[model samples]
Target: MPEPPDPADPHQPIPHSAPWWRHAVIYQVYPRSFADADGDGIGDLPGVTSRLPYLADLGVDAVWLSPFYVSPMADAGYDVADYRDVDPLFGTLADADELIARAHELGIRVLVDLVPNHTSDEHAWFREALAAGPGSRERARYVFRDGSGPDGSEPPNNWKSVFGGLAWTRVQEADGSPGQWYLHLFDDKQPDLDWRNPEVVEEFHDVLRFWLDRGVDGFRVDVAHSLVKAEGLPDWTVRTGMLGDQGEDGTEDAGEPATTDPRTKELGPMWDQEEVHEIYRGWRRVLEEYNPSGDPDQDRILCAEAWLPSQERTMRYVRPDEMHQAFNFQFLEMSWRAEDVREVVDTSLRAADEVGAPTTWVLSNHDVVRHASRLGLPVGSPRPNGIGAGSEQPNPVLGLRRARAATTLMMALPGSAYVYNGEELGLPDHTALPDRLRQDPAFHRTAGVELGRDGCRVPLPWVADEPSYGFGPGPRSWLPQPLLYGPLAADRQEGVSSSTLELYRTLLRLRREHDLGVGGLHWEGGWGPDVLAFRNAREDGRPVTVVANLGEDLLDLPEGLEVLVASGRLEDGRLPQDTTVWLA
Candidate 1:
């Protein structure tokens, strides 16, 4: 492991002044899609361990593994059945320990996803709760309510599930008598727990302690903002299509009020209750307590996936006493506009400042379209279009240029940056999968309007030509591998100077060697209508300027800044289209 930088140099500035996460680049691994070790066509913990060296070589400080716990495979393991043990499909508990050990051996931290809001209905606890009588402690652990009202109607409220339709599901009473309704925020199989219950809190805390004790480093809290809900379960006035609708409201012709919905505004404070801070605070206390004792320098991190839009709501998960950081989804929604990027960056910084906590940004994840695809290139266009539509040639060089520029922008920002697996390789989005092969629920829910996230969650391509792309020696992977990935394999680009792999290495090394921190951001010069320019200076006075051209034309360089790193070769400080440059 690399030694922590010095802290006592007034003139030199403290090395490693940034928290473990501040300068750290996190790589997200969707476990089921990463690599299949057992060749049962499913990726497992041991498969991940086999790829530790590959991750270490990518220059990430930590690997954020999506949920790998035991599950019925619903929601891709997000519906966890066992928090304390690994699923038989992934591996045994020993495999998890070994994966962690291998990651630490490479100076990489392991952060696992913790889905606390709900659990698989098949979970032992939930099953036991269903088997027990009413008022049972196990039943109290989840949201269970009697349907016997003045007239035996539906659920008490009209709250909609995130997966569409009602959030309530009917399950048999403890004694196998009749059925009763229970609340679930997602699939019917996932029943939301009653956070108001004291025992529920203690049980979740114990779950955290169990993992922390087993050598897990931290957690990426799933649906972190959904922990609390309105106790009254009041009827949400039918005004809009649904509460969590991302695009057009689906309630247009339903004879409901389409112009304004009284329930829309009230949803936030009610679902994302202010009391959530207390819940996170409690979890943070458990994390701090269970962290390794001997290493005072080691810091435990808790990152939350907050879906709320406003800064005030987003900051609730990141207050000093709560989670260490919350994901800023602004960049994920960014279009091909420099102004939009600037606004997102500024808004996130201001929000983080307000809460006195660090900020985090992610370009892509398992849920969204890859940046290359989102950037308006033709579906699967290998290289960025230089100027005209016909110039759709594979420019591996330009691809790396874009990757480097994106990295430069992310690293030079005020807080931590998350890079999805295979992003460093400039992997393009998959767009040709047949409908039968699609795995994302979005397709079914959206009625095929959206292509679903399965395009981004395909198996990682490690080799150019080998079957399964070196994910394993299997005839086929858990998910189909994109044909375009073959030419961009790790083996093909390992030592190449211009490879995307090398650019990532160089950028990560620069971030580490410079000891950059949150205090390093210093913006200067008015941003062009289509260009983003900013300078980041370490406390020690080492300044690096990042300039990105989000427009079609080449951008004129700012006077007096020397080019340090260019996404592509630069002539007289002028950047080519779709280019990025790092200047000293």
Candidate 2:
């Protein structure tokens, strides 16, 4: 493999004619755990600014931050109390502005989380809706409905929260009587907005302009598949599980096996409604307004975090007049099997081609178990919510091996890619987080049946020996970091050629140099079912081949293929089990 370029060099700017997002590598920073500049033990915007140079050197085109908006932190920052300001927990608005400026100066674009689906119950709008009583204009801004049962004592529908429990929460009327109930798809503290209401639509449009005016490059729309519900908010009893009880590792676990025939089942009333496209169409217009000259380079992108059932449905959000990209959650949820991986890749590329959009590939995110730990589980094991001391533990060595190989395969694919905050260091979930310290709403709402995402959101380790691994000056982090993280810290891996960090740097650099993200994929025939082999070529016609061995036996490479990089060390010039190789 060629040695990676020095970390000190500046990035070559993208050409103005091409939209950088089409094949960009974007990094996700869950700000609350990225770095804490202050002694607060929680990450903030200033902390992100201090790390901008590191990201630029790592070769990502952009950084997408999880929410840092003013919030009650009920679901971390997803429950937004204020759309226009940074939360005090994440530093002031000035800190955000500085972070944006520093990122742009480093040639890295910035994308912030936009939670338009719901707001913190404490948000001024929500509070006003409560104060205005039932049947008032302010109440119309949210989804409020009368309850069923005697004296309106029962929830209006059979809907359940993704976090668990009833989706409806009744409010206390001013006269001390039971009032109309409001809808909350995730947590009671987060009230779902009524997209059918013009007032709600106008408010979000202004919110988009507010951040765009501050120079944000794009938005990662949270619950982007949501925001619009069925006209009557119908009850869905066809499924055996909770409506939004998406499983761990981005897999769909609706209690029963979903039918392969689309005609046999309908989308739940709260998810993937057709009307959501019109909302994004309007958002696309808002984004275009920022690039009045129609320059593709200046285009503000919107990436959807929608977890739809199929890639074909996912493609709808990225049509020419809608979002630029939606996450390929299907790829993320795949088991570490050659056939599964190849199948999803084929479907994903075809869907993107149909829409004239670049597919977006992601291995892990804040919402799922880190791939380093997830990929190691035994084949066909259930997608676990969280791994505790009593749970069957993943084989650390085996898991990391497959993780490296899986990520190598993902990077070699054709599309934009997202690097979750710490996957570059081969980070694993803090699998044994104690129940008392757990904060994810999924854990509490499910009464521990679902361990939730806190294990994956544990603060990142920077310096191996420093306090909180140098995440902050404080002696601790907001969420506990496992002691095992020391060896995998960034400082320990920086210049080591064989380290995971160095491997990522090499992959990102080669991806750009080869234009692989915009390349076409052609599957190679005559490979075993346990092996995946494909060649990638762009318009320039120079080809790069990627091969992964998922079987127990070693696989031989045909002669004359110049090996560029390998996920694991090759054995006697042969690819070993759970290894991936890039060749030219």
Cα lDDT of model 1 by residue, 1-584, tens digit: 98543221111222345567755689999888788898877778898999889888777889999999989876889888989889998999999999998899999999999998899988988888888867888888888877646754567566566555677877766466656678887778888888988988998899888888778788999978777876666655442122223322442232122222444534432257777789999998888886547353477779988766566678878888889888887555544467767777777776677677777878778776566555544322222111121223334444445556666677666567898887877776666666677665545654554345677787887777777888777767867776778877888888987777777777777766655544455555665687887767666666777888877777788788777666666666578766777777
The clash numbers for all candidates, in the given order, read 0, 0
The best candidate by TM-score is 2
TM-score for each candidate, following the candidate numbering: 0.87, 0.94
Per-residue lDDT of model 2, residues 1-584, tens digit only: 98653322111222324688989999999999999999789999999999989999899999999999999999999999999998999999899899999999999999999999899999999999989998999999999999999899999988777777788999998889899999998899999999989888889999999999999999999989888888887775533232223432224554322212123555678888888899889989998999999887898999998877789988999999999999998888787888888888878887787788888999889988888998888975656667777778899999999999998988988789999999999999999899999998978887887788898899999999899999999887999999999999999999999999999999999998888887778888888999999887776756899999999898999789899989999999999999999999
Root mean square deviation (Cα) for candidate 1? 6.6
The best candidate by lDDT is 2
Model 1, residue pairs in steric clash: none
Model 2, residue 311: distance off in Å is 0.7
Clashes of 2: 0
* Distance from true location, Cα of 310 in model 2, Å: 0.6
